[model samples]
Target: MLKNLAHAHTQKFGKGFNVCNLNNMRAFFLAFSIWNALRSKLSWTHYRSFAG
Candidate 1:
């Protein structure tokens, strides 16, 4: 399973593989949203990593 996942990531970033998985896209969007919120001092969703 690890090997398959690694291959998927390699193919995903390689040439001619333009499709991005939904999970990856969601994560990318969420990351940017968090960054923007931090920079703007705006309301932000809770980050579980930092939550008690």
Candidate 2:
């Protein structure tokens, strides 16, 4: 499913939809599953660091 989604995303968006990025995105989503639990002042990189 992730492979298919990655292919479609690349076709539509042209780049940055590889399996590794998709996996990281999934991890980020799982880590921050609660929308309100996110800190408003933190950037995505910061969140990514925390998630990692």
TM-score of each: 0.26, 0.79
lDDT by residue (tens digit), candidate 1, 1-52: 5446556766877643234443444555666656544544433344423321
In terms of TM-score, how similar is model 2 to the real structure?
0.79
Query: What number of backbone clashes does candidate 1 have, counting pairs of residues 3 or more apart or in separate chains?
Result: 0
Worst 10 residues of 1 by lDDT: 43-52
Task: Report the Cα lDDT for residue 39, model 2.
Answer: 86
lDDT of 2: 0.94
Best by lDDT: 2
Error of 2 at 5 (Å): 1.3
Number of backbone-clashing residue pairs for each candidate, in the order shown: 0, 0
Model 1: per-residue Cα lDDT at residue 27: 59
Misplaced by over 4 Å in model 2 are none
